[model samples]
Target: MAGEELKPSTVISLADAMQAYSAGRYAEAEDIGCRIAAVHPNDPAVWNLLGVVARMTGRQPEAVACYRRGIAVAPDYAALWSNLGNALKDLKRCEAAIVCHRRALELEPDVATSLHNLGVALTAAGRDGEALHAYDAALAIEPANENVIWDRALSRLRLGDYAGGWQDYEARFGRDELPKRDLPGMRWNGGPYAGKTLLVAAEQGLGDGIWVARYLKRVKALGGEMIVECREPSRALLASMGVADRIILQGEPLPAVDFHIPQCSLPGVFTPDEAAIPTEPYITADPQERARLAPIIAAAAGERLKVGIVWGGSGTYASRADRDAKLAYFLAHFNIPGVQLFSLQKGPQEEELKALPAAPVVHLTPHTADMFETAAAVAELDLVIMTDTSVAHLAGALGKPVWVLLCRVPHWMWQYGRSDCAWYPSMRLFRQRTWGDWTGAFDEAAAALQMLVLQRSGKLLTV
Candidate 1:
């Protein structure tokens, strides 16, 4: 529908554009929005809508231009300002977005959306205190609003307001429709399903599965034969959890059960008073896996320090912009002492890794099946360093001494201002000092590597 030429003389012809956008035809939305913006060059709303379409279609620069054009046309339009702010945010232009949001609020004082948005932009820029105040302002107007509430909660958590944060975090379920146990209805947290079958299925990502698997033990503890299911890639790892009586892979419809519950929601269902995150590293690797790979690793003489490394996860483009590190951050210490850093690279970061020198890296890339093989190789590693990727989880599961490079806005599970993973006691976190700054994380990690080298040689170096 966005492909249709603009037929606007007075009113904006945004109907087809909206339709194309809803149908996920990003290109079509961009085409129609562009045509409409060209036709009604004076209309700010047209420009704003065009900006939204362009942003969604991944043409970030065009989107920014569209927003600027709208502001020029209707400088007083608060909605246009908010729209512009979001576009700037999408482009990682937080300071500009902050200005736009502030202007929008000055024009429309009761604009809760603007406040909430301003808070997020500020949080992205690492101004947590100001962000909290902004979110607080938004929530004061619209208390029960889920988006505002969840966002505020995130800010609170980021600022270490765990008392308020966990309460808000508990209300997270009604916000989105995550993966669930595909039974007729939702999982029953009620006791004594003595004669009945229930599916406590895995929904969401592998990290989510690992986080949620904590409740499976309680489910099994209650005599519920919970069938834990996630993607095939995580089957081996998920299987090791003693809570799951049976591990099922995704795409295979599970057997009918009396009731179904998403494993992630167990926190909401069971422990409402306090979230004692069952965060001990329960997921483990097979002993046989360790045995099978020992010979292969033992052949590589004891001289070189084997290091397993992962650069990226399946992070979204916006998420990746902040969470991911430049390859140089991981590669700077490649020649530090005798460490041989093997590439456990996955997703889009593969091409970037290929261009780096091969001396430190061993590419066992996309073809590898299961974490066990990865674990098998990791068995030889003196240490592992990874961004918040699945490889970190794998190495942790295997009880490897892992140094996880953390983003400023770390994943929710990591909480705030912590350097070690409570989930995996063996894991340590090297955090970025500034938002999207990997330099500090790499520098700290490099220094830690130097200490580890000295320690391995039975020399305790003072910090």
Candidate 2:
């Protein structure tokens, strides 16, 4: 009923454009699609083809405009509505995206793809309960849809359903995003390897490596020579744990181990629920590194409450910006009288400090050569405050007093409707109430820091 208005000639041209898009020739597809759109401005297929090409080429705004134009002409077309919803979600316009997706579902109620898109939009809006229902409805229609299952896993995990979530999370290995590991040994089945060596292969972000490092001690207790393979940046930090019989940097020669388990999968093996999560301080700062940095920190901080800060995480994830807080935002709000801010940020983002006019925070990247050095610097601080990042995991692992600034819908591990972190007893979570709003979380952290300073000063005076 929606696309039947297209002429036979227009349909043939649309097919050619779709074939080009399928073959990954987006430019060719876009050229053909644009030509059709110019000639047949009223045809929904032409606009849909143009929108798909625009989205595939990473021009999400153009895709939204194309979809809007198509919807104006053919409002009954469910595909255009669904495409618009997806583009809006990519732009972080969750509420509008949800409405667009629901409208598409109203037009094509049985379409699993529309339901899946709606679920994703709902999740972004932090309405994960409703998101789960949408995902379930999609799964009921297309029982083996990996896209639907994967998103449902995230929703379940965010809602603190670790058991069901982890079970479904195994679907990630089947998906392309996480990348499958092709190691030498047999995949360890989470059982004891009494006489054999167990290799813990690290995967994903540096924060994930640090978060899963806690499971190494548990693996060692299962009675085997524990070998951990980690990225170069995390090598020193994992080595300091002392749980692994050997720490191997990633891309090095594979050691002869009887069994191998992905570092992340270790959680699924051991942790059944939130209460089963291992407590923090499993990771320790190199004692020598700490001793070397402590005097330097004392010299700079003096009597001030030494506060370390990390404003951004790794720039890999598309959704990372949601979790990032601007350095200026922190400096503006955290103008407490007794606190001295220290930058623990690395990577290209550290350049943001130089661009700023009068940055009060002391830059500590020069002192931090690796995770060991970073951990030591963090240990010297009275408290660590940061957006959700690897440094937050580092500080949390070391059992330091760390406050984490969270997006409205943060990572599954942060959970929903909670201020305390189960994995890190010393870590406190400050979450945004509204989507894409960091000011609320930052303001709360500033207020909390003021109280912490007063508490510490009162304790010092008593002594």
Q: After superposition, how far is residue 1 of candidate 2 from its true place, in Å?
A: 29
Clashing pairs in 1: 187-260, 187-261
Tens-digit lDDT track for model 1 on 1-463?
Answer: 3434557443545777777888988777667766776666787877877787788778888878888888887899898888888888776678889999999999999778899999989877767789888988888998887777777777776665666775676455555543222355445855766656677766656666655565676677666566766787777766665566677776786776677766655765554333454545555556776677655554543566777777778764347566777666677854476566667777778888777665456665542577646666666667888888767766666577889888877775565678877667778998887666688888888888877777766787565
Model 1 lowest lDDT segment of ten: 177-186
Score candidate 1 by lDDT.
0.71
User: Model 2 over residues 97-172: C-alpha lDDT tens digits?
Assistant: 9999999999999899999999999998899999999999999999998878989998998888989998778777
lDDT of 2: 0.88
Total clashing pairs in model 2: 0
